[model samples]
Target: MDLALYHPAAGYYTRNRTVIGPRGDYFTSPSATPLFGRLLARQLMDFREEMGYPAGFAVVELGGHRGQLRQDVLLEAPDLAYQVVEVGDPLPAGLVGCFLSNEFWDALPVHRVRVAEGRWQEIYVREEGERFADEMGPLSDPRLEAYLDGLPVAWMEGYETTLNLQAQEWMVQLGQCLERGFVLSIDYGFEREEYFSPHRPKGTLRCYHRHTLHDDYYAHPGEQDLTAHVDFSALIEAGRQAGLEPTLFTDQGRYLVGIGQELFAEIAERTAGQFSRERQAIHQLIHPSLMGSAFKVLIQKKTS
Candidate 1:
C-alpha cells in the first residue's frame, strides 16, 4: 500500500499530470487565491529579517503543486532565493531559510489499523476482482503499536485509524535538513485530543473526486485522491525530538490576518470598482467561514 502511493516510479503524484484543485480532485488554499502566498510571503520576510537577511537564504517549499505559490512569492519578493522540494524526495541538507508545506502531510501514506478484542490489528488491502478490499493482518511495526498506545481504548475499538508514521519520519528528515529558520506547515487537522475525540469515531480519512467527497477510497485506487487529517501534536513532538522548537500554532485565518489583513484591507479600501469579482475572490480566500478557518498553520524554528 505504501509503495503504491509513494513509489518514485509510478506513484499517484509522480505519474499523474494533474491532481490538485477542483478539476482534478479538490482545491487547496493556494488554488483559492494568490492572497495565501502573499500572506505566507509576509511571514517569510519576517523570518528573513530575523536572520539578518542572508545573501542567499532558501525558501524551500515541499509538495509545491504546480508551483503557483512559489510563483506568487517570486512575484512579491524577487530577491529571495526560492526552492521547491518535489514530493518523494528527501529535503536538502544545511538550509538556512524557512520551510513551507501546504496540504502536504495529508497525502503521505498512512498505515491503517483497528483495535478489536483488546488487541490492535493491521488492516491490509487485497485485490478483490479488480477492486481493493480490507483484510486483517498482524501489527508488525513497532511505531504503529506505540501510536495506538496513546489513543483511548474506546476510540480504537472497532474503528479504522491511520497511523501516520510516515509524517513523523518526514519531520525527522526535515529537522535534519534545516540548519536554521522556520518549518511552516499549513493544513487541515487537529491536535491529538480533538483528532481522536469520540466525536470522530471513524477517524479523519476521506477521498476527493471532482470536488465531491466520498468514503470509498478503495473505489478509485490511483484515479482519485485520498488524504488523512494530520495529527499536529505528533508533528510538534517529532520536531522537538529532532531539535526544532515550536514557535507559533494557530488557525489559518488568524495567521493570515496577522500577516496579510492590513494589505487586504488597504486593497479593498482603495478599489473604486463596485463589487468586482476579483475582489470577491480575494475576500473568499480570507473570509472566516471559508478556507480561512478550515485550515491551520504550524510554525517551528530550527535551533542553531
Candidate 2:
C-alpha cells in the first residue's frame, strides 16, 4: 500500500500531473481559498516576531499539493523565504522557522487491523477479479500488538482499526531535522478517547474520488485518494518524546479567526465600496460549516 502511494516510479504525487482542486479527486482548504494560506501566513509572522526576527527564516511546507499554499504565501508576503518539500524530498537540517502541513499525515499509508478472538489480526489487500479484497494475516509488528492492547475494551471485539506508526516515525524524523522551530500540523482528527469511541466501530478510513466520499478504496487504485483520521493524542505524545513541546492545540476555525479576523475585518471595511469575489472567498474560508470547523491545527515547538 505504501509503495503504491509513495513509490517514485508510479506514485500518485510523483507522476508530475495536476491532482488538486475541483478538477482533481478532492479540494484542499488552500486550494479552495487563499484566505487559508493568508491566515497561516499571519501565524508564521507571529512566530517570526517571537523568534526576534531572524536574519533568515525558512517556511517549509510538506505535502504541498500543487504548491497552492506556497504560492499564496509568496503572494501575501513576497519577501518571506519559503520552500515546498513534497514527498520523498530531503528535509533540510537546522531549520529555524515554521514547518507546516495540511492533511499530509492522513495520506500516509496505514496498516489496517481487526480484533477477533481477543487478538488483533492484520488486514491485507489482495487483487481479486480486477478489484481489491480484504485478506487477513497474523499480526507481526510488535507495535501493532501494543497499539491494539491500548484500545478500549469496547473496540476489542471484531472492530477494525488503523495503526499509523509511520505517522509517528515521520514526526520523529521531522523533530530531528528541525533544530529550533515550530511544527504546525493541520488535519482532521480526534483525541485518543473520542477517536476510538464505540460509535466508530469501523475506524475512520475513507476514499475520495471526483470530490465524493466513498469506502470503495479499490475502485480507482492509484487514481483516487485514500486517507484516515489522524490520532492527535498519539501525535502529541510522539512529539513530546521527540523533544518537541506541545505549544498549542485548537480547531482550525478558532485558530484562523484568532489570527486573521482583524485583518479580514480591516480588509472588508476598506473594500466595502467594491463587493468583490475576494470578500466571498474570505467568508467561505472562515465559515464554520466549511473548512473552518472540519480541520484542526496543532503547533509544537522545539526547545532550543
Candidate 3:
C-alpha cells in the first residue's frame, strides 16, 4: 500500500499529474470550489485574531497540493505566514497558528482485516504476473486485533474493514509540532459507532480513477488513488492523549454555512444574471446532497 501511493519514483502522488482537478484521480472539497478556500480563509483569520495576532503566526498546511488552499487563504489574509508542507519536507518549526489539512488521512496506507471463522485475520496483497491478489492469513500484527477492541461485540462477527493507526499517531505528532494553536482537519468519515457498524458490510475503502469511484484497491498499481474513510473517534482520542482539546466537530455543510451565510447571500444578491461559475462551485461545496455532507470539520486546540 505504501509503495503504491508514496514510493519515491512511481507513487501515485509523486507522479507528474499530481492534482485534484479533472485530470487527477479524485476531487477534494477545496478543489471542488474556490469558495471552500475562500470561506475557510475567514475561519483561519479568526484563528489568527483569537491568538491576538502573534508574530510569525504560521498557517501550516499538510498535503498542500500546489498551494491551492494556501493561495486562497493568503489572498485574503496575507499577513499570516503561509507554508504548504509536502511529504519529506521539514515541518514548520514551533508553529503557533492553524495546522490545516483536507482529505489527507484517508490516503495513508492501512491494514485490511476481516473476521474469519470467529477469529480476526489480516488481508495480504501479492503480485502475480503483473496483477495483485489477496492472501488472507493470521493478523499481521498484534495491534491489528487491538484496533477492534473497542468495537461492539456483536458487530465483530463478520465485519471487515481497515485499521489506520497512522492517523492517530499523526495527531500525536502534529500536537507535539504545534507550539500553541488550532488543528483543523477536514475529511469524509464517521464517528466510531457508524464506522464500526454491522450495516456497512463493505467497510469504507474506495479507489478513484478520473473522477469515477470504485472498489478495486489493488487495481492499476500506482495509477489510481486509494482511500478509506477516516475514523474521527480515534483521532479525537489520540488528540486528547496529546493534550489537544476539541473545539468543534460538525458536518462541512453546517460549518461553512455558519461561517459564510451572509457572504453567500450577498454574492447571490449582487450577481443576478451573471450565471457565475464561482456561485456554482460554492453551491456544490455547501449543498447537503453533495460534497458538503460527505465531508466533516474537526478543530482542536492546544494551549501553553
Candidate 4:
C-alpha cells in the first residue's frame, strides 16, 4: 500500500500526480471552497487568543499538497506562520501552536487484517504474472497483535478491518514535537465501534481514480488513490497517551456551523435568493447529505 501510494518514483502522491480537485481523483474540502479554510483560520485565531496569543505560534499542516488550505488560511490570517510537512518528514521541535490535518490520516497506508478460524492473519501482496494477489500471513509486526489486544470488541471469523499503526506513531511524534498547543484533525472516519462493526464486513479499503470509486485494490497500482476510513477512537487514545487531550469530536457539518453560521447566513443574504457558487459551496460543505456528515473533526490539546 505504501509503495503504491508514496513511492518516490511513480507512487500516486510522490510522483506529483493530479490526485485532487475536479480535475483529479477526489475533491477535498479545501478544494470545495475557500470558506473552509477561512473558518479554520477563525478556529486558529481562537486557539491563538486562548493561548494568550503566544509569540511565534505556528500552524503545522501534515500532507498539505498544493497548499490550497495554506493559501486560504494565509489569506485570512496573513500574520500567522504556516508550515507544510510531508507525512514522513521530520516535524519541527518545541513548537507552540496547532498541528492541523485534513484527510491526512485517511491517506496513510493501513494493514489489512481479518480473523480467520479464530486466528489473526495479515494480508500481503504478491506478484502474479503482471498482477498482484493477496497472500495471507502472520502479523507483519508484533504491534498489530498488541493493537488487536487493546480493542474492546470480539473478533468474528472472516470479518476484516484495518489497523493504522502509522497514525499512532505520528501522534507520538506530534506530541513530542509540540511543546504546547492544539491538534485539529479533519477526515472521514468513525469511532472504533462503527469502524469495526459486523455490518462492514469488507472493511473501508477503497480506490479512487479520476473520481471513480472501485474495490479493485490491485488495479492501476501507483496510479490511483487508496484510502481507508480512519479510526477516531484509536487516534484519541493515541493522542491521550502522547499527552494530548481531546477537546471536541464532531462531524464537519456541526463544526462548520458552529464556527461559520453567521458567515454562511451573510453569504446567503448577499446571494439574494439566487443560487451562487458561494451558496452552493457552503451547502456542499455543511449539508448532511454531502461532505458534511461524511467528514469528522477532532480537536486535542497539549499543555506543558
TM-scores of all models? 0.93, 0.93, 0.95, 0.97
Q: Give the alpha carbon lDDT tens digit for every residue of 1-304 in model 2.
A: 5765666777666666566787887888888888777778888888888988887778999888778999988887887789999876899888888789998989989988887777778998887887889988998688877776766743458888787998998898888888888999999888888777777878888988788899876776666678899999889988887778998888887887789878778888889989767778776666678766667789999968
**CA lDDT of 279 in candidate 4?**
85
Tens-digit lDDT track for model 4 on 125-162? 99999999988899999999988884434467787889
Q: What is the lDDT of residue 73 in candidate 1?
A: 81
Using TM-score as the measure, the top candidate is 4
User: Which residue window of length 10 is worst by lDDT in model 1?
Assistant: 1-10
For 1-304, candidate 1 gives per-residue lDDT tens digits of: 4555556676667676577775677888778677677777888888999989876688999989779999888878887798888865567889999889999898888888777766788888888897889889899698887777857754456877777998998898889888988899999888888887767767778888778898887866666677899999999999998888998898887887788768877877787567665577666665679766767889999858
User: Candidate 1 — what's its lDDT?
Assistant: 0.81
Model 1 clash tally, residue pairs:
0
lDDT tens digits by residue: candidate 3, 1-304: 8888889888888875764787776777667666778788889888988999888788889888788888877777777688888878887667899889998888888888887777777889887787888888988777767778766643466678888988988889888888999999999999988888888867998888888899988888788888999999989999998889999999998998899988789888988789988788777887889878878999999996
After superposition, candidate 2 runs with Cα above 4 Å error: 153-156, 270-276
lDDT of each candidate versus the true structure: 0.81, 0.82, 0.84, 0.91
lDDT of 2: 0.82
The runs of at least 3 residues in candidate 1 whose Cα sits more than 4 Å from the true structure, single-residue gaps closed, are 1-4, 7-10, 154-156
Model 4 stretches astray by more than 4 angstroms: 150-155
Worst 10 residues of 2 by lDDT: 147-156
